[model samples]
Target: MTAPATSSGIPVSRIDPYTDASILDPYHDYRALRDAGPVVRLDQYDLWAVARYDEVYEALHDHEAFLSGEGVGITEQLNKAQHGSSLTSDPPYHDTVRGLVSRHLTPKALREFHTYIQDWADRLVDELVERGEFDAVTDFGQAFPLALVPDLLGWPVDEGRERLLDWAAAGFNAFGPLNDRTRAGFPLLAEMGAFLHRMSVPGNLRPGSWGAELVADAQAGKIADELLPALLGDFLAPSMDTSVSALSSMLWLLGSHPGQWELLRQDHGLISNAFNEIVRLESPLRGFTRLLARDRSLGGADLAAGSRVLLLYGSANRDERHWKSPAEFDITRSNAAEHLGFGHGIHGCVGQALSRLEGHSLLNALLSKVRRIEVGEPVWRLHNTIRGIESLPVVLRA
Candidate 1:
């Protein structure tokens, strides 16, 4: 692998994952990486970054060329060692666990939850509207998803929402590094693990909820009992961060952009399209490393085998090559789904339909109540990986 040198002729700084400035505000770093050439090696992390739009898209589409089982997480060594999580696995075995996951998460199954999603959204909006002021993150973002996911997954409703929230936080935290990101994540992960362990036992998930159905799937020789913990853990771990953060990002954009907010406020019919536009502008995950399957040419760069590659979804969405005026956040972008926020290919997000449902439900409810999401100064949560707001205060305009 060629040593990575920045445009300034200095090698990139690979420091403790938590403190690396490039990882902090990666947009600038993405510009440098993408322009430095197709596959610039990062001397710091010793990883190759594919910051250009075309390369990341090609890599995702040609999984046979890039290969995911090696791990989508940063470390090449870790990617190689991974077994059977839907987020990491590639094919064959990946399809098995993913198929089991799909049995309950299918579009029909997802639609089954729309009434529940809208109910939660409406109830929360009603409560917050009555007060006329609320913390968007805690009062609504965290509450709505936390309220619905456990019930939908068939976890016992008792303190499950709080537990699920903690676990989900830790799970995303673990994705970044071993410092505050990974270390602070243990308790939430443990709580989620314990809760999921109980859920995995006999008679937990409702006979229909996928989590419960997994137990039956296990009995029917579909999924092994040993993998049930990880399967359920995947739910608590990956489900909330994107949904919560994505919704937070949407609120931040619509509230901050009065025109955009009013467009939705006017029609309410554009809720789904507006949600897609928001995600296109500000995706939740920044970029993470992937290992190259073999030495190959990608997006005008020579990508070598065994080198770690950075898949910069956030940066790529803004690439000028594919998007006309990519940086513009027009809610009217014709093909908002063209953005890689949900990713592409087999390893792409499986829960995207549910994520969309949450957005649709939330937006529909918000349009009914808020004439506009009055903006307050926003606070960003700095995860090494997830791009999201931690707290966004809003004034509800009825």
Candidate 2:
């Protein structure tokens, strides 16, 4: 990492964060970016990238400076079209929509499904462990959410569930600039959005589920009726890939580090912290773009208004300056909760409570039944805006 070029020139790096190569394994480039400077101009994308923990955390909180309303993705078209989605909105409007969502995901609401997710994990793991070997991502990572989220949100359980995974992947993929990957994902995303929109209809939703609640709110004038579809669409797009990515990464980490698993086994209380540690170590979202609403300075880098900066959450989590032995995964890592795995500030993940509940239930269930976790080579799933294992093979011993 080099220092800033001069008072006139910002430190420039030609690394393309969206390229398949970088997305496959960004830690190397992330270290390079961090070492280069607090803020480095990505010449390829013509965007500023902040890799250090302090700066990224600050940017997430200072939304007025690093605005999300312009779009959080690399593409102009999708961002413009997604203006209605809460992910692309600013405060006031963002607060209203987020508040509506919070009503359904409060601790009490999320706690109701804890037993279900736990039992689901137990049943799924039992069958997989009996087989002696299985692809963790396909069998568990993808399956768990597909089985659970739709039911909770009132989407038809069987219909289009497979496409939901693809849609979730494409949602993040489309976040990047219009590249080969972005272009490739358009059709699937369009289709999935439409399907989810249909699922938002009051008649289509389960009588007492969250999706129905959104409709009820609309009818009661809580939120606009037209925004109902976008609200429901939000539940699927962000939740699926992120949750799947985190869950698979947890299994991989525990399997690879048996000593950590033993520690987790000794005390189930550590399950929550262990989940936080897993996500902190292997963040599902590589980063998201934030457009500068006005001329501002970030980490000493001066930027004009209407500039885009990539807040590298994944890199920030492993920043050496922030965490001791940042690369090592420890279940008992006290500061693990400080990691920006779920991000921070107002735009932070709204589905996080549900995600944690699912993680806790599944991880606790595994600790109780499985004695040893033998993991094989993991197939990587690369996307411009998300990082996760696509196929993780594991053999759980009783």
Candidate 3:
């Protein structure tokens, strides 16, 4: 590893964040990046990195300085691929499209599905408990959202729904730099696009579902017809993968740290805060890049216009400056909600409300039904962006 000095005086490291090794166990690299400085240039990727919590938070909130419209991915190809979508666009237009997608996801809007989601969670946990041992990732984490989100979004039940997880994971993989993993995802992304296009037609989607609403919006001349696929994707990909990562991590974390599980079980009120702690410790999306719109001073480093900087949510969540014992998983942490796992500011996750609902419902159900959560080692998934478990053998003692 070489450290190169730049005119801005920023420390440069040769760390490759997308490597299979790095993706599998990134905490050491995250610590190195944070310890280096507030801003460190990744000489390997020719990108700047903001690993400290203060800097990441500031940059995430200052959309004008750290532009998303140019693309949040590391490579130009991936960024251009996302052009015009809410993820890559600046406000006004970003606000319009996000509003349409978020209308159904708001806390008040989702209240109608409260009982339904809780009931589903109860049933799913009950089945898993009866089985005694099952793959927590597939049987529980993936199962919960896969069962509910598509139905709410109006995806046809028979249209290769089994592949939704693969498609969703691929969509996120495409956000990374052009590695083999990223390249493999393009075809899957296109397939998802094609599927969304087919479902965009008036009669193809469930009439009253969220997907149908987007289709109707496009038909009514409210949004461009071309944007329909991206709009539906805004709901589909993120609503699945990130939630699965959080849910699966929830189980792994609770199981490994029986003390935390007992703490949560004893105080049912800690359910919401526990979810926050889980994502804070293990952020699903590691980080995303932002193109500097203009030259600016960040953390005393002079960043130039057109420079692409990676705001590391995962690193920031574990930054020692902001978090006391940042590496420790304590559900009672007072400021746990401040973590940037779901992002911050305007581009903050649109589906976070629903994600929280799902997490809360599941935890509540588990508390009522299971006394102990025993687990085997987690088989972590290797991908460019999402940090998730592929499988975990688990036993739920009642």
- Largest TM-score belongs to which candidate? 3
Pick the lDDT winner.
3
Candidate 1 — which residues are off by over 4 angstroms? Answer: 1-24, 76-82
Q: Taking the tens digit of each residue's C-alpha lDDT, what string does model 2 give over 1-398?
A: 35446454778887777778887888898999998889888766768889999999999999888888888987677888776667788988898988887676667877766777788888987898889888878887888888888887877766777688888788788888889888899899789768866776678888888888888888888888777877887788667888889989988999999999999889999998999999999998888889998898878788889888888999999999999999998999989999898888998888878778778888877987899998987888868877899788899998
Screening candidate 2 with a backbone cut-off below 3 angstroms (N, C-alpha, C), the clashing residue pairs are 1-36
Instruction: Give residue 141's lDDT in candidate 1 (0 to 100).
Output: 72
Taking the tens digit of each residue's C-alpha lDDT, what string does model 3 give over 1-398? 53966776789888888888889999999999888888998876879989899999999989988999988888887788786568878988899999999999999999999999999999999999999899978898899888998898998889948879889888888778788887887788888888988987789999988999889999899899888888888888778999999999999999999999999989999998999999999998898889998998898899999999999999999999999999899999999999999999999888889999999999999999989999999989997878889899999999
Decoy 2 TM-score against native: 0.96
lDDT (Cα, tens digit) per residue for candidate 1, span 1-398: 23455553433433333465655555665665555665565665667667678888888887776776777767444344344677777678778888877666667877766787788888877787788767768876777667777776787766566667666666665645456666676776667767777788879777777688788878788888877877776566556877887888777888888988887777776877788888877887775556678887776566669876778788888877778887777887887878888777786777777778888888888888777678687777767667777787877777
TM-score attained by model 1 = 0.90
Candidate 2 or 3, higher TM-score?
A: 3
Instruction: Tell me how far the alpha carbon of residue 119 in candidate 3 is from the true structure, in angstroms, after superposition.
Output: 0.4
Question: Could you give the candidate ranking by lDDT, starting with the highest?
Answer: 3, 2, 1
Clashes found in each candidate (C-alpha, N, C closer than 3 A) = 3, 1, 0
Candidate 3 achieves a global lDDT of: 0.89
Q: What is the lDDT of residue 76 in candidate 1?
A: 44
**Local distance difference test values of all predictions, in order:** 0.72, 0.84, 0.89
The residue ranges of model 3 lying beyond 4 angstroms of the native Cα positions read none
